[model samples]
Target: MASLSEEEQQARETIRYLVAASRSVPGGALASAREDWRAQLAWWGSQGYHGVTLPPEWGGQGKSFLVQTMVVEALAEADANLALLYEVHNTLHLEAVWRYGDEAQRRRWLPDLLAGRRLGGFAVTEEEAGSDAESLATVAVPEGGGYRLSGVKRMITGAGWYDQYVVFARVPEAGITAFVVEADTPGVGFGSPEPMLGLDSTPVADITFEGAWIPEDHRLGELGQGYAIALDLLDGGRVGIAAQAVGILAACLGRSLAFAQQRRQFGRPIARYQGIQWMLAEMATDFAAARLLTYEAARRRPEGERQRPLYAMAKWFASRKAVQHALNAIQIHGGRGYLRKTGVEHLLRDSKVTELYEGTSEILRLVIASRLLNGYNWDSI
Candidate 1:
């Protein structure tokens, strides 16, 4: 584990207790009413989770990203999906405001968001664009004093339920523009939630913007700054996801270690078997290295130096290891791990998405490679 300061250790312990107190099995919530999950999210955010790294003036702890990461890792140990909701809401939405929003705009929105009174979401992904910014299809047409935006954004995390969304659209007069789109906007329609493998409590859907009129005051940053804002969000999102991967790995290791000691095979605990021991050892080693990389990325993000490549590296390595560790966790548990009630399978399902979401593994690899080819020197690499 990375060297934790006294405060970080306390943050971890506090979040662990809070998660345990408010957390419930996501499986049951999936079958239960939506309020079951929504209420749990509210309770979780009330613990200062949603604003882990936000400014103190907005009811946040004003902690560093590292401290926020530790809290995320701890909460994810109990509920990864809930952690996902908090991560996107903080890193993607609130961070955007802190980075781009004017003082008046911040005053208008930050309090509710930081207090978890209103939910926030990001809507930028499109079918055609996927991970390629050059293929953006959403458009913002200038009107009297605002913009008429039209586009379809898919795979939005809080699509049908969020109170607000920071959406990206191509501006006719400039390049890409970022807008704070309220849920109540006329012509702003949400498609039915799509069924997902994991993170069942968090809904993802397609948002269709059909001539949605947005005031100029709603624009985040400035005209033609949407692409940069989107990239900025992804950088923070990657760190959050990396911390999430660390949490998954930590949970997997803990579960596997406990299972290995308790379960028996051939009249002996599986932990006594060399084969199982090897798997456990490898899992621990890989997790340690990934955690180190994740913490380093989190630490460097505030410095603003080559963060894109560093965060990409952390996300790529940690995300892949999370999936592998979860798979090993299930294998060590034998047949029982495959069962839904065991929760190991849930980890696997959740870990797989870490590879595919945020900045996808393929995109990260390309980013690293491109950066390297452009003379990013690293003798260590």
Candidate 2:
């Protein structure tokens, strides 16, 4: 990656400092425990880490998206689960509300959201609608001064934990509508938690609504715009995923390099051997390449021009690279890497989630291909 400006460099150092300062806090292992993750997010919010991209009045630092990306990457270097939590908060949840919600809604929701006093959830996925968000079965019907929402949202990241939920539901005449439903609403309920392979820190479950009623003011944007809003959020949000991928790769590379230099084999350090050196060299190069791609996407994304392909490209490449690097790092560590005690296994487990979330590797490829077919920003890629 090219050198950052003085301002950007300062942003990087600031986030790095915050991440380093939080080292003493029990985050990595703590993240695997469901109940403990709320405290983790609160601690980060106390550091002003969760408000990078939010407005000044919203308890955020009012930083640029690039700075938020830097913060996310730094958080990932220390704790992947924390990084994911931040991404979900800033990119996945708050960004949508801030960008699409009306002024009154922003004033009402942004405070607790940015302060970490209240967690927010994005309710879009359904049992039948994994990638096809339009196929969501959740529906909202006009009732009195509000709408009655009835449906189930599965695979919600903060299902049982969030204080508020931004739920997308089909309306009788308005098509898909995004509603801000309080988690404790009379008709709101949570299902049993789902078991996960990684990111166990962030609890996942289902949110079911049975005629959940919220004021008409709770709607996010104009009626029928929920799907479009969600799609737009995902387009730029993929950059967060890319940054996370780079972060995971950085951690894997650092751990692998340290082990190679310290672990002795064949009567000398393995770092001295050509085989080990080759693996380290490849990991370093790949990590750097992934970082470059991620930063490029972060830089170009907010311009709001024809940048979808770039975002998709960054996510596809970086996420795939992260998973591969984690596996390769494990390979270099041999049996030790396969074991949980080495911490390499954790990286491998966490890195796999990158490929599966935001946009799956396959979905990203399709996005890029579709944009390319339409000649959208063809020269840039």
Candidate 3:
């Protein structure tokens, strides 16, 4: 592994401090901060977390992509839900506007979003467009000087709560187009938050657009560019999710190590036993490997399309290991890990979502295989 630069080290320290501040609230250590998310979001924004990867001229920190991944990892250690929200906002929503939007659009939305006064969402997934994102059913019909979008986007993070959304819909002449729409648009409505398995703090819901009017200026890039934009945004988002997986795995490993050291069985510390020792060693190894892969993906993000398969590999391996590490942590804790209060069980649940989102484990495997079969050259490989 390469040595960390001063900028990366400083960024990690800043995120660590910010995460620690958000860890405590009115009621004990803010475990999930489910009810206090509003305050937490604002606090994180105030601390400059939302703009870590944005340009300095845009009132952002102008940090490197690698640094941003480190921040995401630290945030995930504090709360996976908040980490996901942060990743979506910065990597997907904000990046889309910065990379594709005109100056006027950037001036209109970037300030409030970076300051954390407003939140943004990326809406692309539909009821039937999970892995098959190209099969979008959303329609964008031209009307006068603008278009009226009509579609229902499902599993949107910050759906009802976000101030604006970067939506994707199909145009009659175009294949898939991206548009920015405010949440308060006349025809825009949100469904109740779904009862999800994990990410309780950042509940997702369906966003329905019933002829929601979108001005021409709100369109991102050229017509039919949504597919490319989604792929670009997802490449970055996958790296962030890999960082999140590393965070969760780190938490599980740390807890399990402590538990093994203290919990005595048959009059000796469990840590002394070879069985417990091997589990800890494996957890540590996975954590190291996952973190390295995530960092490598972030570092190679500037290479664009050529490095996409690396993102998929990092996300898949890290998330898969995260789930397994969570289970191992629980096993080490025995019956105590089964109890919800121990928090190990919660980590297990959170790890499951990492594999589901940002391209599932199965999908990512296909992506990596496709790249390899095509004779793509990766230095490390």
Candidate 4:
């Protein structure tokens, strides 16, 4: 990887400062739990980092994806929950609007979103559709100079809290279309947050739309272009997810190493044992590989090539590697790793979700195989 330019270095320092502030809040890990997390995110937005990647015309710093990735990685290393917030903004909201929204639409929403004056979310997943996004049942029908949206969106991160959301709904003849729905829209409502195995700090819930109405101008991109927008956005989002995994693995390895050097077993430090040494070696190897793949994907984007396979590979590999690293860290700590206060247990629990969300391991494998066997030639693949 190339050395960070001066601007990138400054952005990194800013993220580090934010991380320090985040950890200083009362309640530690519990500080960001539930509604409190929204407050925290709003506070970060107040600091003017919310639109760092948006173009200058839109009140953003106008930085490249690399800079955004660096900021996310730094935040993840400091606090994974904060990193998740950035993912919600950068991947789900910012990228979607930038890619799909028309000039007027961008001018209307980008400023507030980029300035952090408001929060945004992406609503796509449903009870019947997860990986198979094209099979989504949410429907949008043409109406009086606008569209009527009706459907249920499940497990949307920051759903109830965000001020705005980019929702996807199926159009019978035209296919899926993306719409900009305001939180206060007449027929938009959200359910209680669903309990999750991890990321409890980041709220997730189901959203229901009953006769929701939005102007046709709110549509993101042309009709029937929602799937393309989603795929491209996910490709970008995958890099962020991979970065989160790297941060988690790094944290696990650091904790495990410290424990190994201090804990005594068989009348000596466990770090002296060959078994412990081998486990550490494997963890280190995987962490390095995952990081490289992630950065490589980030780097490949500027070359005008689609990074679908690379991003999928990085996301899948890093997520799996993160889980294993966390589990190994647990083994190294024995009973201490099982304790919630030790933090290793939480890391392990949190690591598992990385593989399940975004794209599952199985889904990514199919994507990789398709890319390889067909050389990404859709006509043949």
Candidate 5:
């Protein structure tokens, strides 16, 4: 195993404190989880841990990608909901502005985002177009000095709650273009929150843009660049999801092992049974491998390497492993796992969403296949 550096060690300590704080909160479900996230965000901002990845010009810590990975892993181990919030805010919203927005746009938004005064979200998913993102029908027509956007974005994380959204809409002549739209803009309305299988604490809803208008300066990057931005954001978000899976798997394994060691069957602890021992050994192996793959993807980011294949592989495998491990944990607990009080049931529900979001397992396989068949050099392997 590799040793963690001084900074990484400090980050781990911070995460331990954050996790302890989260456990002190009263409720165990998603709503309470989101509230806990907000509290942590405020604390992180006050502690100067907000802008660890942005440029110095943007009031950021100006740290490297490795630091971002460390922070994300630490947060996920504390609370997956908070980790997802940070991922979407930094990688999708703040990074988009930094990477593609004009000078004025960056100056206007990056400060609040990095300061943790504003929350950001990316609006790309639609009811008819989930994985087939390019098939979106959202239209942004030129109107006077700006554009009028009219469409619906479904299943948007932080939809109604976020302060701002980076939206992608199709233009007549320029093709798909990205825009920075405020949540309170005219004609922008949010639907009721959707009842999801998991991650319910991180609010998701349908956002309707009925002729919402924004100045031309709000455009991000060149026209027809929305697809590129979306892909890039997903690449980063996938790694965050993989980290969440690792945390969940660790929790599951710990609980299952404790149960096996205490619960007796036939006047002997279940941990003595060969069948239970084998199950635990397999779970531990899966957890270790998944963590390695996720960290490898994180390390590749700073080198300007195209890690789409590795990112997909890690997200797919980690999510699958998390789901399977949660089920096995439930089986080990027998009937107790079925109850909400045990909390294993919540893990089981949450594990499924990791596979469904950030590109489904099937979509990730296709991405990996395309990269392999394109004749890209695999010398790094």
Candidate 6:
């Protein structure tokens, strides 16, 4: 991995200490963040994490994308749920508004977001449109001075917790379009959070838009541009997910190394054994490689179209390694790792979702294959 600048190194250290301190409470960081999410959000905002990549004029630190990814990795190492929420809010919502929203919209939204008065979410996936995102069942019909959105979006992070959402719905003649809808809109309703195996700290629910009225100004970008905008947002989101994976992988290696050193068998520490040594070696290698892939993807983000496949490769490989290392960590811990109290199992659960979202492992393979078949030079990326 490329060496971090002095500023980046300082930022990483600061966030790592902050998160480690916050997670020191009972049930660790995940439980604390989950139980008191509002407070956690406010804390993150006060620390300037919500705007790490935004311009200074917008009340942000105006840091580079690499710095933002570094912050995310630190958050993930301490708390995967916090990292997931941070990634979704910054990469998907804040980025969308900053890059696509008009001046008026930015003035209306940026302050509250920076202050933690409002949290942002992106709503796009539907029950039938998980991987095939374009097959949206949500529809927005033109009305007087606005549009009426009526459809359901499933698996939305912060579905009820978020103050506002950037919703995507198919228009009669405009195809899929994006709109910024306040959660309290007259027709917006939310279902109960879904029960999941991992990352339980992060809430996921379905949103129902029963003819919600959105003013013309709420529409993001031009008509028929939602698909492109969503794709662009996903590129950034993929990089964030990859960073989160790197964090999880780091945690897996750290926990396994400590366990191997202290764990004794046959009158000796397990770290002295060849089998345990090999597992630690592989886990360490995976952590290093995933970090490099994620850093490369973040560095090349400005290349636009060329970076999509790089994002895919980084997300895919990093997430896969994270899951593998999590399992290995558990094996190294034996009975202790399998138990929930150990907290090592949580990494496995959190790592599995990385492969399924932004783009699934199956979907990412096709994306990379398409790039290779197009005769693009793989070395250039």
- What C-alpha lDDT do the candidate models reach, one value each? 0.83, 0.82, 0.87, 0.80, 0.80, 0.87
RMSD of each: 2.3, 1.7, 1.6, 3.0, 2.3, 1.6
User: Where is model 3 more than 4 Å wrong at Cα?
Assistant: 24-28, 32-35
Which 10-residue window of candidate 6 scores lowest in summed lDDT? 24-33
Cα-lDDT of candidate 2: 0.82
Candidate 4 on 1-381: residue-level lDDT in tens?
A: 345577766776877777677655532354255566566666666666675667676777777776677666766665676677778787778778887888898888887776667778888899999999889999999999999899999999887888889899988799998888999999999999888887767778999999888889889998999988787778878888888888888888888899999999899999999999999999999988888788777766554235578888889999999999989999999998899877778777778888977888999999888877866743321
TM-score per model over all chains: 0.94, 0.95, 0.96, 0.91, 0.92, 0.96
Ranking by lDDT: 6, 3, 1, 2, 4, 5
Which residue pairs collide in model 3, if any?
Answer: none
Task: Name the lDDT of candidate 1.
Answer: 0.83
Off by over 4 Å in 4: 1-14, 25-31, 303-305, 376-381
Which residue pairs of candidate 5 clash? Answer: none
Candidate 1: where are CA atoms >4 Å away?
A: 24-33, 377-381
Regarding lDDT, does 2 or 3 come out ahead? 3
Model 3, 22-113: lDDT tens digits are 76642115454454666677777787877677888998888889988887898787678878887888898888888898999999988888
Residue-level lDDT of model 6, residues 1-381, one tens digit each, is 346778877877887777776554443446564547767777778778786778888898988888878878887887788788878888899888888899998898888887777889999999899889999989999999999999999999989988899999999988999999999999999999899988887889999999899999999999899999999999988999999999999999989999899988899889999999999999999899899889889877777667688999999999999999999999999999999999898999989999998889999888889988987579886
Please, what are the lDDT tens digits per residue for candidate 5 over residues 1-381?
A: 365567756766775675565454443223474556666665565555566777676787777655566566666654566767777787778878888888889889877887778878999988888999998989999998899999999988888888899999999988888999999999999988788887758788999999988889998988899988888878877877887788788878889999999999999999999999988999999999988888787667654328788888889999999999999999888899899887777778878888988899999999888989997455674
Instruction: At residue 83, give the lDDT of candidate 1.
Output: 70
- Backbone collisions counted per model: 0, 1, 0, 0, 0, 0
- Candidate 5 displacement at residue 58 in angstroms: 2.7
lDDT string, candidate 2, 61-168, tens digits: 877788888877877877787787778887878887788888898888887777778878778989898878888889898889899888889888778887887889
Model 1 per-residue lDDT tens digits across residues 263-316: 988999999999999999999999898888888888877855366788899999
